[model samples]
Target: MTNDRGTSSRRIFAGIAGGFLVSTVMTTPASAQDDPQHGLADIIVTAQRTEGRLQDTPVSVALLSGEELATRGISDPAALQGSLPAVQFQPVGDVLANIRGIGTFNLQPGADAAIAYNVDDIYIAHATGLTPVFFDLARIEALRGPQGTLYGRNTNAGAINIITNRPRLGRLSAAAQVQAGNYDLIATEAMLNLPLGETVAVRISGATQKHDGYMRDGHNDADIYAGRIRLLFAPDQGTELLLTGEYSNQSGLGAGGSSPCLATFAVAGCNRKGWDAYAGNETPVPDDFRSVENIGINGQLAHDFTWATLTAIASWRRVDYASLTTTGDANIPFGDFGYKPSNANQLFTGEVRLNSLASSPVQWVVGAYYSREKMTNRIDRTFLSDTLLGVSEVLDRYRATSRALFGQVTVPLGSRIRLTGGLRFTDEEKSASGVATNYFVVPAASIATGGAESHSGLTWKAGIEADLARASLAYASVSTGFKSGGVNQTPAGFGIPSSYAPERITAYQAGVKNRFLDNKLQVNAEVFYYRYTGFQELLNIFAPGYLAFYTVNSQKARVYGGEIEVVAMPSPDDRFEASLALLDTRFTRFDLTSFGGADYSGNELRNAPPVTANVAYQHRFRLGSAGELTPRIETVISDKYYTDAINSVAGQQASYTQTSASLRYLSANGGWSLTGWVRNLENEAVIYSYFGGRGYPLAPRTYGVTLRFETR
Candidate 1:
């Protein structure tokens, strides 16, 4: 795709100029002067650990408000795919998020996501754990690029920070919402805030959502229930403590297996081959449950001094999760017996930090972080044939520990300029072990056990930012990101570990944020270039009597991209938001050799879309003595993308578009509201990716309605 960001500058300017002209004329008329003026609202974000205006934050971030999320029916992280221009989640099993064309591909046990998910400063350790329902949230921040300095480990791609509503003191408030949608979908959420003693307060929130499967055989049916409780205590003027606990339980049939394509040239929607054929072939595998329990406590004490304020924070968190699934054979239609796999994960993290926040020109912060994660998984395959019975089992375990020290400093040079710099040093260690056992008739059994392999690395990042004006700012930074290496679990029949190296990327970026038309419109733009070394590439190498797909650090890549966002409110009751993103990613050098070939270099990176865009519009209207109604519409579009690096001659998914819309009515007292929404209005036949030699189709069109009540 063409990088036409600069070309659109004039168009953006025209839009701002037109709004100015209209505003100038409106203020001149008496009736217009009496009419309500339309303008932008301040966007608050927690991207910097501290709450602040989004426009003032030096980091490149995309903020999605709670209202915006509701309008799009985004109850889970998977629904966030394509909602942001620079964000993409490949829907392979659970959603794997990608920021700026980089992401992890494994959802299996003992694997860590390249992107980290943090909610209220507590790290969500597992991908499945992030699948819980979301409610009573303040905002969801997508901080693009590497965020290692502040977010801790596994942030090689970026970080998603979900800020929840905090406990409110001296107040009693409650809100409830219920949603019903197509395919027998039903969802409910509630939140309550209460003040107990003079210095203590508590807030509780919960949600339950269930939906029928889109595919046949009841696969993909989702049932999730989650709740959280937060308590706050402020005994003194400068000291406070907060405690939070949360639990989520999910039970449902997992994704259906994909069928092999009988012909390579089958057209769209063809069911003769691909995932559709296997939709009904799999049965419910018992023990297919995913549950998570998390407990965390954070305390903050601030002492005011004549020069500055000394603040200290102490926190600790733990997460436990378990899940089970069934793995079927490739293509052949055998009786439903297959392998049943189960996995468990445990993670604990603690952090301490101190910062200086004074009226002076200089500000800084320093912190230390420690975290450890352990995972255990086991799989048993039972095969029953007319003449023989066989059992094969494999167990894998991994443990990772990380420690980091980080700090940042900001200095204001003058009224119109400021400088910021930050750095972090992280040390990470990982170990993996596996064992396999096989039993067959012939009065014989074989057992194979393996020891563990350990790897360690130290990584760091440095960056700078400059504020040019109250409305415009510029930042340029060099940040480093690292993804830990691990062993491949695919059986020898499929693939064996090749001792891959850690993947690294050094990114450089510059960006500008500006406001125009008297704050009626806001525009933010950023461009980034990345140099990637030891890039991990999965290649299918054909060996004697087997086909193996293994990871190899064989490629060098370059990725340059930019994103632009415009938020405008032409009238008090009308708002419009639009964003565009263009990316140019390619493998600069890729040299791989196997028994089947010598090398394949300069191939385009697989599954990397070059162009993506999103646009949304909303309007609120008053009903005089009655109430108000708000209507919203949004569209997300992406250009054609390849599913594999070779840019396969025939397996490319053409460019596609998906749209969603919502309408909500609120009571004049602001105590009640009714909302109706529809997603994938086009019912576009979109394909996100292919697995096991077949393409997996995207979710079909879905719709829902919700009612909400609140009291304060």
Candidate 2:
């Protein structure tokens, strides 16, 4: 039910954006501080962990730089969807991010992840530990709404910060790259920055990737490996320390194994089958694969004492995953295979912070947090059948603990208004134990019917700000968030309910942050509203002879959204960007009596989508000494969404428009570079769905070439 990304690649990207916008003409805008091009380049965000200046942070953030992720060739994180604005990325097998419509499509282990992924600030409770291949980066921030006063708990659908690239004491940089495209694509990356004088410094990074997958058979494929190490320490004027270690390993072929399509003309709603083809069904899983291993460590410390400034952060993580599939009858594929789903997780986190220096107008902060988690799940559908029909065999074990205490403040009503407040208090506990067999696997019992449960909460935020000039700012906020409640690894003949609760949100926001003319143009806008009381959903109850997975509770819901971001540099060689998002998710009350008694009130909320937009353009050329050339184009648009939540018929995802392009070259003064890229380019038919529509296909027109080197 997905097709359409054609029209000769939109007339070849509108004839290469109309011959480069009529021979480009512009200047100034590089976050202009006396002209680094004259504007748009002053982004310093800690998203409230301190440091501000992203148009004065009124939250509606979306900053991605690392040279704009290698001039738009974006590496990973599910390709970051529209890069912002309603941000929705669902590549399952761990990678389901939804902002503004909330997210989480049950990854099991009692499910928990309503957006809240961090890197440099720790906190990354699985998602396969992010970045399947985004290299040494230095920025990526997207904060939408309900961040619960400086990020706490699951964040209620907001917060994503990944800041890499640290370790520079005296500075001695180096970099490397290599890539080749089309199906047999290969990638390699390297980085080193070592300096041991005046107080240590060291950094090392690595990446490797392989590809061959576009599914239509030929069994999807890809393998990846990653590594990182960083350490920095300085003990003078005001102490500093940082340490990190990371790892990643993945084996693919999984994402595409779950493909099932049959909607040549169904007739439901939300574009049920936008085009035609394949109404027969029969792709019976065969080469479905998955493997992931992750490891991590992080430690950071800082001290300033000029009046006060002390911080500490620590984290440790581990994840392991395995997969295999064939949910039976695709027209009979070897009769319902088994031993697929698997997981193993371990995580730990710690935080401590305090600040108060610069007296006078008053400003403050305080923090404390702790976390501990452990999970183990393995479901094997004990198989054996030619008519033998044997089932059962499951195992689940979970444990969780969290503690929190937070604070915030800011006061000054005179010189441009300002007043903010924050609070956080949390204490959580979860427990589970299981075992179920007998289908020839013996031992059938103990699924922990209902055991351990504890939840405590208080999440808050109150805001008011005004600057209106000197870069601009205007904000208003009210927030609350938290998501914690566990058990429910289902499957043990689906007796359901190990436990479930703790899902809450209350958000209301207003924003405006601008930087005009002299600054080359930067605008940010936001409007949000959310109130979900116990909306923790993950339903698929079709019992008449099997298949049940639950984690319900949807008493009330309503999510409002509005987002806008625009950046323009008119000069300094041209750059333009735009974004927009408008959403209105529903479900005023959902009552699913295990499937028959369905009262899904307003419906519409699975992967929520009301509208989305995008635009981008780039220009810069100066081949004088045979160096420097840049050309780019981008476009993304979507509308018509329903991935499920009582909206069946293979849950639609119709409306589509996607395009990408690039050309880069730099030398003279820079250590060498080259790039040529093309992605999707309208060869689009990208569908990555599951839950009764089963489709996973992304990658349709790929082109590549990259070679780079650097040193400083």
Candidate 3:
């Protein structure tokens, strides 16, 4: 079946490729070129912990401006999968983000994500903190591959840096936007900036969105409210301080679960392909809902000296999340059961660093970092009947602490070549305790367990970059990444291991960046290889009369991939951009002793599609003495991929394409605008996870209109 799908995918892309070719030929002319006033704009990034042009950064990075996000109707990180290369997002109980085929699958508090999500240079220890801070942002940077030195542990896959708009010392401005759409959608956003004195300023922003469910049973809905405030103080030329506070609340029915067919592919909707409108055998439980609340505060201080600059950062965040979902298993005695999970997580982090002046011949930075995370997790199981019947419950508490010292240096070898090296030493410790109770038993028996462990490691990176031309760069690098080990809070009588070993990865990569046609065309390409060891995998063991969950280390794996991105502005009125990623990943040796000693070796990793591509085109029509009209079309393509490590037939999400289109009109002064947009034109419903022979789908087709206003 996989082979047949591969052939079918090839045929589909052939047609798409032809269509793109003809469109380009019809819209672009040989005489058309970028005018002196317009071309590809420069993108500034801080991928290396310093501000620089994106083209000059040695790391592989993808940057998206806040304006672009708003225009595309992207309100959260989970929506980034279709628009970015080598990235995927799935929102289960908590958000799961993957980059380059590496991510977290375990939901335990003791487990850490391979990909790190950061806001304003402060890392978010948990994924729940990442869902609500997508508004009023300067830009978002997706750095691919291991961020070993600059970002210490839990960055085996890479990092996402979300830079928010800061306070302006001498500006007073305001902006507001509102949107209305089908499915009873309504969204509003506002921003205000005020200058308090000659050296003090403040910026405040807020957003709220509410929409009805998109499912036939009204299971998928949205309700979100978020706000942020920034305060800046710069009393002198050499010293600066910035403080930020944020809060968010999200509550609704959340995402629904729908399957095209039951496992074995012989049930209701068996003949369906994509997007069955809640017609599966599974039924939604009453009062199914999800909620998350987050609060965060952080501060940054910097002092510049003659030879170098010293900086300090401190942050604290608290996240409370809960969800109630149905198991959707018809085989159960009474009916589908309800699964409710809740968590209260808190994190505290601090860092101190110093960086050499930009004018120095050799640039360097040294830093020390510390972080502590604590969480209380609980899960309850109940029968979904008129009278709820308690079945089972589990309660756990986890704590983790980490400390690191890191440094990086860049030395000029010649006029056009530079050498770079970095090292980081990390120490981490984790402890967990839990109690499990079974109410189904006559007397409701219970068991308790607890343990602690510590681990340490050293990770490093080395690279060299050279200027190929005035506007081009070529570079190569190798880096190592680490994730801390964790304890399993299960009864010792189960004979399960007390702890699991840490996971590691070594990555080698090379890339080239280039600009041509007088900055009218930009192209970037990269290839990478990774050697992964001690892959951490969560396992379920069914003992004589009880079930236990624990994490284990798989043998090894190999991952190789390549990506290419192109942006062309043949003329000021026309723009075209495309990106493609090719990935090959396999578990070289994976033997699951608990699951009847089955071997999943030679299987492809979950969510790692062999081929993925995104293409977008837009054109502007200028109206003299009036506003301008712009229309845009975009498509995202993906090859077939699995949703679980076992790679079962029911877990395979077939190859598909999702398309979206939008039209916008802007006034001559650019202070006001209106946009009409539609996403998933064909209503492609791709499943993100599979459970109890059922598949949970993503968003469906939707249309909306947005109006924006700003004061200068």
Candidate 4:
């Protein structure tokens, strides 16, 4: 890290420290029982596959409840960047999440994401399905660092768990909400719960949204519809069953790109354009409309025994989508790079586990997991010029299978210490077959290619925790992570490798959780370091008269980071929260053997900002015999970062800050509420991603109002 960047990180941390010191010295101790509204509320989580308090879990994780999600208007993972420490997002038609500088480097089919995403304990195999599962959720947990032992494969970065609200045994309740905003935006959501019998209950929920484009010519809009149904059956106190079904459809003038010249230094050959302008060469540029449809069904059964509990889970899901998008040469006119791709995927998963009862002195869990996925896809390409015209079509089929066995045990030592250990063994296999035909060639040419690959590995974790005080705990752990390799679908005779190697990581982490001022103030801090090997890197080869995509393994790399979070509730009406994260990453040894042995060692990893911070404050006022009003303000700051492995000037994003505010009013009976909100008050055109010469900017200034009602 540079001296300037280091100094900037220190200054941010200093500000957070200042606030903590003031809250500690100025506030008087008060019992939470007497002043219930002045202290933080309890948050329950299932990070370790069981119910537990957030502060008691021995890991670095963040949680956001359903109420928080609705209040902040956060319906997808892309909107969770600054709300959590050591987290970031990049949207390239499909949303991708990054934690602690590790994320997906390959966007091709059959490639797995570093961050594992799960909905109600069921793994989601594809990125296109992540958005729809966020609705009607109870809470979402983001675990930072490696979570390979319990989560199994493809969790080198971390994991996200989305827990939904289940049916109540005997209750009748309903809620509805409507929102209207600028850009002709409108959204509606509703939910209902009903009891069928003494042992059966059902819940249903749906949401729909539409909005105009953010582009200058009204492109890049959003249209989404989703619904879910859950049924719960409890035969007796020892046995329970739950079934879930979901469907969603998303269609719009999807993601559009702008010229990078608008965000970087002006160059002689660059074409400067506005952030909202589309960067393309086609005359009367066509809208990049895309659509996705998904369906899923899952079931869970559990039985409690005298000594242990047995649980089983099974799920099936399908996703279909189509898109038309511009490729490289986004800034050059008359470029021949565009394509339309259509795909369908089907997946099935099953798991069985057993764990000791909560009263057991030595808590233990054992589980086995299995998953299979099949995909079919077709791509149509067009390359036209003054001298020649070429059109090509490729049809491909792919399949993947995975199996795992995992176990974890925790034992108490003495009176204030505990030891934990875990292990998981995973086996994965992938195969692909494809045929390509080119029409504009001399007499037309056709080629075929197919290959298969398999990988197996063992991942483990061990940790120790100690209670320093009644309201404080300290813990440390070392863990390993794994992501399987896969085959490429490119045709033969192109010198493209058929497959890539698996990537692995060893992470060392330590943290402390503490509450002060009579439990009204909380402060948590953690630091982590990773030794990464066989890093998979996706390469896009663009040359004269040729275009190719491939993946290769980088020899080695290193990543290190730290985070601090503070929350203070000085009084019943005032609240404050702040967080800061610092990161440093580097590729220790990497060589581009396919590109004439070009060495790229010592380069910083892409999207790994050296400094990031968030700060927020809120205050509530009581209206005598009427209602209550609350207002909030927040700001997020990020340092300059690169969007490509090469770190080109065109892919660099400068430091920027964004601010948002909201005012909410609630009825005296707590049955209805209204909120007015505004985001990005400065209308800053902050670049989030770069594709060749094309740049994608974050949303500009937006304002809206929401009205909600419910039965209490």
Candidate 5:
């Protein structure tokens, strides 16, 4: 299968490249410093091992600058989905990030996300610790399709790479900002850059944000708090070194819970008895507290060698978190029960690579990577009775080790064309164990399960790009991606395996990128087709007697989609941008013999939205000789999406539209800024997700203000 796919991909690549002739006419020139309305800028991305213009790189990539991100109020990964048409960001928990509608459904301790995340080339394994924190950054690159060639391991959907600003030599700068608004919200951020000596520099940044939640509590009112810090160091001319470290902590009550209505008194569309209790009847329950602590250390070293540069990176991260959740069935009248889960994870990664300068026709890079992680999780279920006694205890442990070798080369056919190819081989091993004990049961019984799995695969990519003109380019590529498989521990009756096989995807993509109107307009479009084999789908098997849910794998499938983005700048201070995506995904061959003779072929993939769109406008004005103000507005829209693959009509989210606006005041020196913003302007009753027998309500209308300062 692999060979056949490879051959077909090669043919497509050759045909696309051979059909178009490279043109040297200068089309439009776009600079990175310009706003979206001014035109599309030359997007430099690290899709390969090093930074290069996106048009010259033979891969499907999306670039979002820091200014663009700030305009949309995207401080975290979940909010970033609004910027990319081809990607979907569904928030399950702190660490759970779904990309392209494929990811881990359950936020269990041992589960892994389908889409991998990398920050400055360091892979982050835990989902809960990857939450967004605004920082000084260069650019964000979203490599679409499969990124197996460069990222390696667990990048079945794609990869999101974040690059931060490094310390500068012989420069001193500082900036600060503050904001206040509805819900008594306040936020502040500050940064300072200082050069210690002729060859040494230090950069330090920190921020703290707190907001009173939108939901009215039945008990005491609650608020959310988050904070982070980053430190960087660089010394010398021939050699450059950077070190970054950050941490975030949060504590708040879970969203409101609903009570089930009695069968005899249930109404078709009216609110149930307990549904309006918080708003009318009594004081809210005591707010639950959730806490998280994360610490990460990353270091990068680069050496200039005239013809090539040698780069090495090392990183270590640790996360500890605890949360208490209410678990009563939403529609039932059962007493409220509490489940507390605590987890700790540690990860270490190292990478070394060498890249040849673009001056050489044969620009190339080779690298090796190693990663190891250890995780532990504990869950305790307790009844909210007068005694507050514990009912059950569940413990899980996971350990994984992965290593890979990867290399890529780009050969310039001439001034107007280039060819790129890359390959990666990865080996991974994982082991997991779980124990569940029910102390409140009759005899105090306990169940134990353990499993281990190892997988190895080779992924490759090939592409060709033709520069039609300075402002326009076209490219085609074929790539592959893989996701590691692991154990499934439900109960004996579910027939779920103790382990599963790894899933793989082979993808083909073609696209065009262009800038026109003297860099005032930029447009990009791409189409992709993917064949997925041995797909690991999570099946929600409800135990007959016990109230439990189990997940397992499905079968082969296919997915195809197209994305388009346009950015136009009518004037230097006015910007407009829009993006749209359409996707068709289906399960081509699904056989469910374990449960019954059921065929799931031709079914729509779960949580996959058929259409998504976003639009935004921003204008900046000079307030006076020493001040400026910018006001921006944006909207995001999505079509109905299924929460489960069974294609059930009831388990779907209705199409919805959300709008947001922000206003900012900046000092003439650009060192300080103040901003006010509001989200979900319509107060739309959005539903983020729904499955099984319950629905997770979306965040309500929220308003906040923020202040920031910076130095360079």
Candidate 6:
């Protein structure tokens, strides 16, 4: 452990820090020759405001349907990385997100995720808000590239849209599933749908999961519960309405970290632990269990008229998250680094859109959006010796309000080409106030930091699509995205410029979608380039003997990438799919005034892997007198990636591959089934992230069996 004391006043600090930070399907059609085999199903998506065929959409999107999730056991957001190219969710504390090298690394108060999350067209306000649990889902879509023209702020990267199953007025159904796995893992899920009278229907669903920690050190365990209720009404021929309420709760032991290199990142009295032998030998034992609670209500209404169709959506959500975990060395007087944090956020959003109903050369969609969010955060940093830093408290409160109007129109040029354009004007206001207290300060009163700021901008998109031979399309587009700036609560007192600058991105992309071999095989490919200004990052600074968390800004960055997706249905019983993501990222310019004479130009962005690929194959066979049997296998491979802005090997996740397999058996009626699965089949301790010199290795090999029942 190196113990050289450095000046604490410098703005840039990366010597050490805390927690970790930042898929699907298809369907198309069948040609004449494909009649002998099961055709790839036609998929419908709402990537644009209106429902349309997936392959015909101009944008790039990935889809995973309800059946896929049920088969793969992907019930949470963290499990989504392996199934989707160029998408990631890792590093615990902050649950960071990165899509095509665009994501937020700093998770200070008021900082929003670059990749936004939306449920049924209603936006989720904060990055750490409810990552909607997957149960009774219709489908999940990841819209890649800039979507600011329609989705609004915080979508500089892209957006994730989740749609749940809607109630059926004339159907009654029930379903249930149970799973048990290694590490004492147990999970249960159930759903019910009922019809009332002739005009109404209701649906209810619930899920719960519990698991023992994989490590003897007693970390990385999970306990979760979630439920939802929905009601649908169609009182007349032209009017429809749906109401929904949902809740999610989580309790678990947080992730553990290990120092890859004992000298560079570890402090005195800290023995580096490897991925195989994780230990809390010097950590704060009996650490407070991390927990999260989320509650939400959503409503949707639609009416048809002679001129257009009007759709209105309203939503409200409240989220509370708390965590306590180990961070740094136990020996350094002020370096124990274990801290406690709490965050509570409340959000309300409303949107209304009108779509042209009449057939015309120009079809259009226009909408208005409004949202407000209130957030409060409290961080209590612990020091082994209070005399070293003299302080350990932070309380912050922030509010953000936004309003926007957007419209898009499309015109078909004859039969071969279509031209489309869209624009949005957004106005946002933000205010924050916080207090920091330390023993170094003479006065008994705490230091005050907070202020008011506002930002507004116009983001737009333009694209052209050309129909090619054999149900294929080629598209090109250019778009711009926006993310508002925010204030920071720091121990540097109130004198420093306590807020960061906003971020802006301009992206250009081109892609091709094709279906060949009698529509039995599908291929989609895209290439994109991005220019970024005012990138935000968190700096862990140690001034003399004291430390504080601060949000910093960088000048500019450049990122370019491409992805390819392929799906093949060779026969009615066999399927093969693969996806690959290639990214090249660099900071074009990075020189901060506060960090004395340091340059980070040419460093790769954190959490952006240069290369990643996934492959999977499944085969089904008929069993005499029994039913059907399926065997499936998958693998994910990735190149090395960094976890910090400085790009140190000490904070990097080395390249590795993960393999998984499953075997399933189903009854003749398809109403009941049994599945056995195993993940990380190789049992390789692949590290994906790091925090406070501790590495977060991927979970070891896990095998489980699942039984499911359903009725119609």
Q: Write one digit per residue (lDDT tens) for candidate 4, span 1-712.
A: 5678768766755654454444334433344453445587767888888877787788888778887777766665555656676787666667777888888856577788889989998889767876542567798899888999988888888888888889998899999988889889788889999999899999999888787766654445678889999999999999999999999898876655444353355541122334442433333246466899999999999999999999999999999989876544435434645667788989999999998998898889999999999998777665556655444445467999999999999899987899999999998999988876666567777778568889887899999997776667788899998887887766666666788888899999888777777777888877778998988777765544445567777889999777888888998788999888888788898877664445778777888888888899999899977999999999889888876777666667777788888899989998999988888887777666665566676666778888888889
Estimate every model's Cα lDDT from 0 to 1.
0.66, 0.71, 0.79, 0.78, 0.67, 0.75
**Model 2 TM-score on a 0 to 1 scale:** 0.33
lDDT of 4: 0.78
Per-residue lDDT of model 3, residues 1-712, tens digit only? 2667546545544544444333333322222453446888788998988788898898889888988878877766656657777888776645577887888877565678888888999999778886553678898899999998999898988998999999998999988988888889898899999999999999999998888876655566778899999999999999999999999998886664454445544422222454364543355556778899999999999999999999999999999989876655464335565667788999999999999997898989999999999988887766544455553445467889999999999999989899999999999998888877756556777877667879887899999998877667888999999877787756666567778878899999888777677778877878788999988776655444344567777789888777778899999899999987777778899986663546888888888887889999999999966989999999989887887777777667877898989899989888998998888888877777654456667677888988889885
Q: Candidate 1 regions off by >4 Å? A: 1-38, 255-339, 358-360, 381-393, 438-464, 490-495, 537-550, 594-600, 644-651
Stretches off by above 4 angstroms in model 3 are: 1-37, 131-133, 256-260, 265-283, 328-335, 383-396, 491-495, 539-549, 594-597
* Residue pair clashes in candidate 4: none
Q: Candidate 3: lDDT of 49?
A: 87
lDDT of 3: 0.79
Please name the candidate that would achieve the greatest lDDT relative to the true structure.
3
Query: Residue 239 of model 2: what lDDT?
Result: 89
Candidate 2 residues 1-712, lDDT tens each?
1234224333433433332232121211323453544556677888877776777766887778776676566667766675666777776666678887787877566467887888888888757777577888888897877687667988788888889899888888889888888878798888898999978898999888887665544334568889899998887858889998989888865443444554545563223544321111244445556888898888899898877889899888888887765544342233454446777888889999887875537888888989888877766543435544344434456788888998988888899889989899998898877764344333433333335678887888988988755666777888888787676655445545556787888888877766667777766666677988888887755443234456767888888756666788988878898776767777888876563557887787876666677888888897778778988888788765667777665556666877888898888777878888886688766554535545554546777888878884
lDDT of 6 by residue, 98-162 (tens): 88878876647677788878877788866556543568889988889989887888888898888
Best-to-worst order by TM-score is 4, 3, 6, 5, 1, 2
> What TM-score would each prediction reach against the true structure?
0.86, 0.33, 0.92, 0.93, 0.86, 0.91
Candidate 1, 1-712: lDDT as tens digits? 2346334433543444454334323331122222224566668786666556777777789878887776567787767776777888665556677787777665445556668888776676656656367799888888988776677556766888888888988899999988899979899999999999788899999999898866554555678888888888878776667777777777676443343332355553323323353353344445444444444555555555566555555555544544444434344233223444566666777776666654656777778887787777765554444643444445466787777788777777767566666777777766666655444435645444333334444455555555554465666777777766655544443334535567777878766666656667777777777888877656554333223345666568887777777888777888989887776677787765443443546555665666677899998999976999998999988867666555553445677789989999888998898889888898765555544354555667889988889893
Among these predictions, the greatest TM-score belongs to 4
> lDDT order of candidates, best first?
3, 4, 6, 2, 5, 1
lDDT score for residue 533 of model 2 = 80
**How does model 1 score by TM-score?**
0.86
lDDT for model 5 comes to 0.67
Poorest 10 consecutive residues by lDDT, candidate 3: 22-31
- Give the residue spans of candidate 6 off by over 4 A: 1-37, 255-277, 280-284, 328-333, 358-361, 386-390, 440-445, 493-496, 594-597
